[model samples]
Target chain A: MTDHAPKDIDTLIELLAKLPGLGPRSARRAVLHMIRKRSILLTPLADQMQRVAETARECLNCGNVGTADVCDICANEARGNGILCVVEDVADLWAMERAAVFKGRYHVLGGTLSALDAVGPEELRIPQLVDRVTSENVTEVILALNATIDGQTTAHYIADQLEGRVTLTSLAQGVPIGGELDYLDEGTITAALNARRQI
Target chain B: MTDHAPKDIDTLIELLAKLPGLGPRSARRAVLHMIRKRSILLTPLADQMQRVAETARECLNCGNVGTADVCDICANEARGNGILCVVEDVADLWAMERAAVFKGRYHVLGGTLSALDAVGPEELRIPQLVDRVTSENVTEVILALNATIDGQTTAHYIADQLEGRVTLTSLAQGVPIGGELDYLDEGTITAALNARRQI
Candidate 1:
């Protein structure tokens, strides 16, 4: 589908279509909406994007993205507890922060260990995590990885590396806070049953 | 939910959330993805947006947006077939262009006549359309407004103004091409039956 929209407008649509969850049709709609609301939406959005493009950077310490080199979390000395939460990516780190429960700092692994993709300990920030554990005197390491097979494999590997150096724990397997029993998978149900708690 | 992400990152997410089809959660996800793919996606997108913001403008003759005073469609003398398609907005004009069937120029009404909102003929491009019909030697005018009530009301108003000046037509309502009878709405089915052709 082709419209005689200006070359710049077409380029904008093409770039917008590359965003997650937006296809060509939605991208076109978004561009049209931006054009119609040029003073309010388009100009501001463009300015914000330009600012972000100039300033956004990954946190060297935890892989979290921010305008600064170390990110706000890594820079805040108050959040540096004796516990460190290990996560697969910055998104996971952000999710944990949203829960507002984990007060300690995080260590983003970049990605899990994937033998199929030739990803190993060195490919991730595993070495840096070990260095941090020793240097920061961390007493506990929480494995906050996903429940996927790759996630479990990576967790096991990290657990082996920090075996005697620090106490290791993982997020529990059970029904989610407001999840229904009938909707859960059998594996989750079995895991929850085996790890039942006393009332 | 709040994270210790940089203030700039948070502001970017907040602005992105204002876009259509995106909530705060999706905006956060999109920001994270853009940050991760900064070099390939984010930077290029920012550049394109800035370019469009600087150059994009509405055509003086028609209401279509382009980088020039007159839009490409309006400037193309070959497309000036004495047949003008009047649309409620630029998006409808774009949709017609995507179909690649229409060869005539377009006149964007900007919006329909809405008494509730106090919008009248002067508020839209009604006078400009009337002027164009005579000055451009337009012999036919297709009202390609939407099927909404406001759309039909506006179409009838335009038809009244240009009654004897040019032949007036509108998009036909029927079962869409490849549409199934079972999935069709009652109104559409009735319309299709009434407009049935001889086999």
Candidate 2:
């Protein structure tokens, strides 16, 4: 609520301010930049934002986000059969996708199980995953959860629930400690995917 | 468009894909992250985005973007005086503000006068600037143009137009060749501000 003309610039800054790493100050700076580059940056950015605001959606089955209901991986016929790579979130799913290895399908866990946060299987998409294993003819489940305690705990819980029903594996070591799939390079993600071992 | 469930993820991805530094792929990843962090990140981000999209605007006088029409800087009675710092764009104005050295007022030219691009005085709000100089009681004019050929040419033109009417000066010579003022650190900007010499 500034005492100004309040037009294009304010709309842009307000949008930018909601970004993960941006505050009011940074948002202000970013808005100014976009405005200055209106032809090359601002106009297109505005158009895209409007378009996306009207289009983006989540995959109901896999939790992967897309401009569709089921998402590409889930809908693709070429993806590996009955082998779902379980990920903590979509970033991990994207990391796996970027590798272009492991043509298998994916399952997004939404988040790790957290006792401190009182998270449980029901809180995540675990129940749906269990249903997918049986209904989709899934033969293997790769636990591509993050290496944090909560992530591990969630993985173990899922494994225990689905034990003996499907082959269980996890991404192999080489992922740096405290590493997030979002921060990993394509090559590293590929290597990790290729070398994935049974848990 | 993917072939999956709920269909909302599509809307989210389409919106996210439009963000800066994001493509369709990255947008999917980002949307997934937000969905996963729904309670923690997504809800708040969505709320903020919606709110901002509804309320942001620009300053009528200085062209500064804000939540209001006049903008905080222009509307402030404390900021008014006959000293106007003319900048090639809003980014330059922001950099000057970040340096926190100037206290008078600002005049955003929108862009420099570019001959190759066929940009002229009318396209850049130059006439409005001339109007402000006389109407606002401005004594000093700081030409904070970028260190580019077009920028310098525009600066010269403005200085020529205002010759004998006000004290005209340009930012000092430490600005790197072809470097954007936005890329420079706070210290460099501060030093540049401190060392600004007469044109």
Candidate 3:
């Protein structure tokens, strides 16, 4: 609530501060930079934000965000390889896509089941995922959940529910492609060693 | 250009990455957060950004960014205390305002004199600052430029230009208040000792 800038500008700063990884000080600096570069950066960003606000929506089938009811992957016939990749959130799905190795449709669970927070099977998209597996004729389900305790619990629950119905899999635990062994945590090092290849 | 998200969302991320302190990863996260909280955060932020984009402008008298030709500080008669504070940029002016100790109006020079970049006094608002000193009946001018080499050079040049007309003063150089001696650079320590005051 700085009196130095106009009210609208201060409001913009407040909103910007709410963004992840941006605090009040950085938000102020960002606002000042945008104000200075109004024509090139600020105006276009404002337009884009408005357009996204008006059009963006979650895909009804997969829980992925897009402007359409069905996300691009869910709508594309080419992506329906009878393999479904289940992720904890849209960010995880997007990360998998960035690797460009997985050539199949994805189901975003929105969140993992958290017993501590009273979150259960009904809280996430687990029911919808089960329905999709049977309806979409999915043959294999890949669980790409985070390697956290909650994520593991959720994965196990989903695997038990879908047992014998489809081939269930999870991402392998290993040393990252370019990771240095010295910098890796103890758990990762153990996993990499235990899963050591013949080569 | 990620093929995972829709075109508009990708565009939004790209534009957001151009903002200060935000990179591609943070921009993607921010876009996702905004889309997820469209009703509460995204829509209002877009509206505020658009408002500021349309209304915000630099004050003609002082180069301060506001929603009017003359900024609030420039328009305030009470702030016209016959002492003008000059800063190298709008951020510095805002910093001075944050301190809330300076009761006089500010003149933003836009940039300092950089010989390497061939930026001279004419490139800045030096001429306009001189005009304001005489037109506004100012008796003292405080040069609150940075302690950098270019900033010092600019301060000295301005002081020489307004030597006999009015009292010219530059911000004092010393160890910053509450600064640890071990963390301070040698130059600051030397300046603090040289300018030691009697109790």
Candidate 4:
């Protein structure tokens, strides 16, 4: 920004630059766009951010982000079909919800177990997940974790803890709905071939 | 976002998506990052945006954005070196300031003369610029507009109006600093060749 730019605008750009994908250049562009569209973008975005700051909270039972102690998913009774989907992060939980295919409640693990970073089950919501499995009418546990090593390690640990208590399942690994075989890696091709089914 | 997402959080994501270079997916990622770093990013960013919304205004003298009627460069007596650098927009003016090469104050044209868009001298700050050139101790005018058709047309218009009144110049054309000759376009190479000088 110019040295003559207002201190407030400079600070806004600085803060916006700290976001996930934005750096100084893109942040400046975004700020310029906002200032040009102040009524439509700047003021409304500020008001909305303030509202989220005041109201956003973590769900007490599932660790999902919402406004109340328990998230709407965790509070609803019809969605609980004795199946609890375990995810690695709130973003993943939200991604699952967007599909609108799953009718079961969710349990957010916050993160996967990582020995290099010194993260463990205690650091995640693994204990809360185990407690929910026992308290809720959960008959099956679906581990929808990523295919990363740490995600698989965490899944194996959870399975060991509830080996015989509930039925354990995981998301099927194969070619995605719109995926092409030419673009897929060997591991995916092998999985898809091994899991071949008849129509 | 999930159907169970808090209404305020959802609204925040929607508003953030309206920003330039950001879409729904990036907005969700940004919201997640802000919520994770609430104290360091979300609250402070919201507060700073509110402040900018209340204080930011276009300078009456030059159309630059600041917290006052007159921009800092326009008000600074030391910068009045009898040279006014004319630019097409506030962002262009800011880009010039960042280079720190020019010492004179600036005149933001707000926009270039565009017949297709129905923009003319009246729509821009052309009248104000003409008044400044006469009222101020301006001995020269630098047309630092972009190398586009609209920009050239605007420069020609300004030059015709202010001919013989002041020594007028435009930015030099050539390969950019650190630009490779192999990657430069033929037009740039031609311009550089035509304007070549002895070392």
TM-score of each model, paired residue for residue: 0.93, 0.63, 0.96, 0.94
lDDT top scorer: 3
lDDT of 4 by residue, A1-199 (tens): 3444678888898899999888887888898889888888899988888888888888999989998889999889998789999998888988998898999999888888988989988888888888888899789999999998889999999999889989999999999999999999999999999999999
Cα miss at B154, model 4 (Å)?
2.5
| Candidate 1 residue-wise lDDT, B70-148, digit = tens | 9999999999999999998887888889898999999999899999999999889899999999999999999999988
Report fnat for all candidates as fractions from 0 to 1.
0.62, 0.13, 0.74, 0.71
Q: Candidate 4: where are CA atoms >4 Å away?
A: A1-4, B1-4
The residue-by-residue lDDT of candidate 4 on B146-165, one tens digit each, is 99999999999999989989
* Cα lDDT of model 2 by residue, B24-63, tens digit: 7656655555554555555544444444444555567876
Every model: Cα RMSD to truth:
2.1, 7.6, 1.6, 1.9
Cα lDDT of model 2 by residue, A1-199, tens digit: 3413244445445645555555667666555555444455554444444444455567888887676788777888878498999998777776776676788899988788887788888878899999999989999999998877788888899999899999999977567779999999887788788877899
Interface RMSD of 1: 1.6
In order, the Cα lDDT scores of the candidates are: 0.88, 0.72, 0.91, 0.88
Alpha carbon deviation, residue A179, candidate 1 (Å): 3.3
Residue A28 in candidate 4, Cα distance off native in Å: 0.8
lDDT of 1 by residue, A35-119 (tens): 8788888888878877888999888887778788897887889988889999998778878887889998889998999878999
Is candidate 1 or 3 superior in DockQ?
3
| Model 1 alpha-carbon miss at residue A180, Å | 3.6
DockQ for all models: 0.62, 0.18, 0.75, 0.68
For candidate 3, the docking band is medium
DockQ of 2: 0.18
Tell me the lDDT of candidate 3.
0.91
lDDT of 3 by residue, A108-199 (tens): 98888987888888878899989999999999999999999989999999999999999999999999999998999999999989999997
The CA root-mean-square deviation of candidate 3, after full C-alpha superposition on the true structure, stands at: 1.6
Q: Which scores greater on DockQ, model 2 or model 3? A: 3
Q: Please state the CAPRI-style docking class of candidate 4.
A: medium
Candidate 1: C-alpha RMSD after superposition: 2.1
